[model samples]
Target chain A: MRLIHAATGEGFNPPSAKDFELPPFIEGVDWATKPILLAFLSVIFISVFFIAASRKAAVVPSKLQFAGEGVYNFVREGLGREIIGHDFLKFVPYLFTLFTFILVNNFFGIIPFLQFPTMSRVSFPYVLAAITFFIFHYVGIKKQGIVKYLREIMFMPGVPKPVYILLTPIEIATYFLVRPLTLSLRLFANMFAGHLLLLVFFLGGEHLLNGVLGLKLVSPFAFVIGIGLTFFEFMVQVLQAYIFTLLTALYIAGALADEH
Target chain B: MNKDENALWSIFGYLLSGLLVWGGIGYFVDRWLGYDRVFTLVGLLLGMGSALYLVWLRFGRHSG
Candidate 1:
């Protein structure tokens, strides 16, 4: 009976070996290698673009100047001045660099061959968050002494005494714990999820087109969804970059604000 | 305003407006993507982490 059971069809139906294969994109790279490579490439690309664009500057503005200035003003006037106030000129370069870098890298995610979103890597977002974090807080403390800064973040002047106790802990936790995490994760998750969805639809479409008989009928629907998602992904790519920069500015404001 | 006060206000205004703008973008992206809870959860974590890190560096670190 034992020998018969061992030889039975039920046990013979082993899982398909194909299930163990690595996806095409990730087949060669060592641990998180693709993201790192993409990030380095993005930096180089951005650096070269900026250096070339900024090589010549004119009062009347050349095509390069126009393009550069357009982005500069978009962030500086549209985002920076509107949020940080007119005195935001000091931080415009940093904001400009941040916005352009993220935008270009996010764009790189969708391009073939380099199909990874660099910001989807936790480390990249974390580094950006850390930089913004330091800038705002440092400016805050420098402007308002340590004691005042603490009071500004922790204590609201108008709240009742009992409420103050409750509010203080909540405020402290929200300000100190919650902010940076959300900032990094917001960019990370959007890019991560967006990339994943694109991958699923795209690969699903490809598989359907190439897979079993009669299953090919489903390929058109999958292909349509894939095409639609590509457009949607493009919008998200721009939106996420804008949000990352906007949030960085917001945190800076919160740190420097006298009240909540 | 004094130079310091001007600087502080400048940063504050930028940060506040920036947050609202980005926060709105995040909300819309989540809505459009249809992830609902997942998007909100991730956004919350990212936003909180960013805020906390900024605060720590500002107050915790001695060197500017």
Candidate 2:
């Protein structure tokens, strides 16, 4: 929607998909963008925090140690143990890293001066999902031999022979294509939409201010809603991270399960 | 929160892929055969039906 003030002759350009097409920080370096920079920063930040938290290990734990261990134990017990079952220990490191990395980068969306969620850039989620896809499939292949794994995935027992024609392709697609695609798309779509929602309110509020006196009064309402939604977005960010990690664990669990 | 809730997502994935893969084939067939939306609709119906059946086989049969 275009908001044009007749008297001022200034038009409000509503935020669109164009807003997501961020420009490079460097003049000519196409890959040097805000999302890439923030992703690197998130990795560094997580590493530093965890390293520092564990550096001073004590029986009577320090606050930082408690916090670090809190996050670690939560992922290890809550996610890795409960979801992944008996052989959960080996996957803890991967699950822990995935949770913390996603949580940190997602929180960047609401952080001042670093307002973009890295996953909003679809490529980041694509890479994460690809890693998850390979890891789970590899785990399955290792657990079950290639022929057995393929058989289990392709043919669900108890199904009639004639039905295999209809169901086999769906089964293959669900495992290989659908799983990773949905995983990445879910994260990417949520972050993309959340950022866009915030942009609509905040940008609309800003544009409203440059209007007549009546519109100026309405701007505060927009800002208020924007602030409220920021809190909502924070909850969503955490949930999305949790869900992504949880699903990864679930996929691993499914792969490791002996029976289909 | 529970494993069942997570299975719900798998059901969704199954249904989505079913529609996409089958309907996609239909669309391509239509393009190849120079037909309008005839196969596309048939493919979508076939997809939805098969997807529901698949879901029943995976999840529903366990209960009943």
Candidate 3:
């Protein structure tokens, strides 16, 4: 009697970084071409959509107006209010832009042809992180004056002299080194991992269905898992976008606050 | 030394905690997804690699 090989059958090649490649646009620009195009296209699309939506102001509001207002209010109230406090409204535009830009790019990752998440490329998220870093630091220095802000950041009120010697170096390292690193990595890693997982499940399912025999029964299971993972990826796409913006606000709040 | 420095330090603390919490979550998610120990191990390596690169940038490259 012949036994069915479940795990031994030809399985789908697990998705790797190489699987996600961008087509070349011209001669010298190969990898960078697609991302640049996507970024430019995203900016144009978002700008056009918002500008068109708000072009006409109505008392009752049209479908476009509703969309604009809903997105604006959601980012302003849900994320900004919760994280940035009273001054949240001031940064609404930046926050809205960040959210919409990231959300669109992330959704692009799952789209059939445009399968690259711009943020997954380190440079994209690094730029945002640098912007946040500069904004918060500038606000801290400008609001408190450079001297006062320095004092607030490095010297706490209650620590002992001996503790200061030990803690000061650690504190200094944390401020100058870790902040931007985490900021960039959080968004980058999330998009990278989420995309990788979706690739694995979908590609794995395809491979199992087509490449293997007798183990065809497992194809149904792989399909179910693939479907389930896609739904989860959708949730993650939104959540990561929210978390990225939320953390930016939180960092800004830290810069703006006086104590604690 | 000064209030601005203290604020910076405080913000850094907040950032560190945030990173630790989120990174820990990602690590656990990899474990839960049945990727075996390899996922967590890869994350650890990535974290260390990032940390080393950051140190090199901040201290090694910038000092000159």
Span of 10 residues, lowest total lDDT, candidate 2 chain A? A1-10
Per residue, candidate 2 scores C-alpha lDDT tens digits across A21-72 of: 8999999999999998999999999999999999989999999999999999
lDDT of 1 by residue, A1-260 (tens): 02233554533222232222224456665553666667778889878877777788767878877887788789998777877775688778888889998998888778888777778777889998888888888988987888899888776555457745333554565556556767788898888778777776777677677767777898888879878988898899999898778877766665666654
- Roughly what TM-score does model 3 have, to 2 decimal places? 0.74
TM-score of chain A of each: 0.84, 0.95, 0.88
Candidate 1 per-residue lDDT, tens place, B1-64, comes to: 2234433533443344334433555677788987665665565555545444444434345543
What is the two-chain DockQ of model 2?
0.80
Q: Give candidate 2's TM-score.
A: 0.95
User: Candidate 1 at B37: error in angstroms?
Assistant: 22
Better of 1 and 3 by TM-score: 3
Model 2 residue A146 distance off true place after TM-score fit, in angstroms: 0.6
Q: What is the lDDT of residue A242 in candidate 1?
A: 88
Best by DockQ: 2
lDDT, residue A175, model 3: 60
Error of 3 at A23 (Å): 4.5
